[model samples]
Target: MKLCTLVNKDCSKAAVLFNSKKRILEYISELAHQQLPDVSKHVILDALMTREKLGSTGIGKGIAIPHGRLQGIEQILAMVLVSEQPIAFEAIDKQPVDIFVAFIVPEGNNEEHLKTLAAIAEKLQDKSFCKQLRHAKTDQELYAVIQGDDNG
Candidate 1:
């Protein structure tokens, strides 16, 4: 599925002011609450914290995708944030992270999670796409970039 489809205008945020992973996860978890009402902030935090224990989700460059598998979740939920200041996430490339996409998927939906991660990673690799995302002036602009439609 397209990122814009999963991360709609309601959950997408631009120029998010966060300085650390804790704050970022808190912010994204709040957004996820809009999609999954049953998912408490603490639950999201635990998932993220647990995922970090495994390894840093910061794949490369200025991007980070933190994901977790939860037991009670029935569907996949995503939250995208563009930070006002890049956080010092221990990324694979050892660069600080400015763009983040956090995902919470059902425990049994491993394949779906992989597919979504692949799609997100592929899209993020495009220089133009990353530039547009970084330069986006508003949440809607960011959504347009994720949609990959200039005319939208």
Candidate 2:
């Protein structure tokens, strides 16, 4: 599935000032609650943190794709966050990350999860696309950019 399809406008945020990986994760967990209110923020945070124990999601070049799977979610839930300042995330490249795109998917849908992860991995590698995202000054503009609107 398309990354845009998994993302909802209300679930995204822009220019967040969180300065650490844990804080960013926590914020996105809260953001995820906005999309799937039935799920607990603590649960969401736990899932993401559990994944992090295996490896850092930080992909380098100032961007990170932090995703996890949840038991109750039927479809993928995504939230994008751009920090006003870069934060340390134990990236493979050992660089701080400034952009984060977090996802939570159904626990049984490993195929969907991998496909979505690959799609975003390829898309986010585009410097132009990331530049547009970073340039977005507000949540509406960020959503527009993720949705491929030129005005963003």
Q: Which candidate is the best by TM-score?
A: 2
Query: How far is 135's C-alpha from truth in model 1 (Å)?
Result: 0.6
Instruction: Please list the C-alpha lDDT of all candidates, in the order they appear.
Output: 0.82, 0.87
lDDT of 1 at 137: 72
What TM-score fits each model?
Answer: 0.91, 0.95
The TM-score obtained by model 2 is: 0.95
lDDT comparing candidate 2 with the true structure: 0.87
Give the per-residue lDDT of model 2 (tens digit) for 22-110. Answer: 99999989889878899999999999999999999999999899988899778888888888899999999999998898898899888
Runs off by more than 4 Å, candidate 2: 149-152
